[model samples]
Target: MVASLVIGILFLVLGMALRYWINRRKFYRRSPIGAESFSSYEKSVGIKFIERVGKWIAYALIIFGLLSLWVYSREKNDNEKQTKAVESTR
Candidate 1:
């Protein structure tokens, strides 16, 4: 449960980072002050590349988070079953 919960939290953080980055890119494109920094940023790292990577990463994180939840629940259920079996045998 702890492992799954940690993984879920990590996934959520990663997904948020990608989303924030994507939003930053969009914001830079529109905001005049961001134009200077964005141009340099674009030159150093292609805007298109970040856009594509960000979207894919965000999607992957979402999937990972869901998987984590599933695993945690499954583990908890198994633990409960085991405890019940032990009690019954006693």
Candidate 2:
């Protein structure tokens, strides 16, 4: 149970970090306040491909993390219910 919760939290943080990195990379790729080169604003095909792939990876990680947490909570609730029933019988 604890492992599941920890894993879920870890995945969630990793996904958030990955997303932040992708956004930051895109933001910084642009030209500064007054740039001389127009090429700085242009995104290469490779960069676009990486960004698209990274975006999907981040989304998958986030969804998997949420699902793990949901499973963990369900297990915890079931355990609690069994414990309560046992106590009531005693």
Candidate number of the best TM-score: 2
- The sequence of per-residue lDDT tens digits that candidate 1 reaches over residues 1-90 is 789978987897888788888887677667555443554755647866868887888989978987897898899999999999999999
What candidate 1 gets wrong by more than 4 Å, as runs, is 31-45
Best by lDDT: 2
Measured against the true structure, the TM-scores of the candidates, in listed sequence, are: 0.71, 0.85
lDDT of 2 by residue, 1-90 (tens): 988899888988888899999988778766776322335335476677888999899999998899889989999999999999999999
Q: Please report, in order, the local distance difference test score of every candidate based on alpha carbons.
A: 0.81, 0.85
Backbone clash count, each prediction separately: 0, 0
The residue pairs that clash in candidate 1, if any, are: none
Off by over 4 Å in 2: 32-43
Measure candidate 2: CA RMSD.
3.2
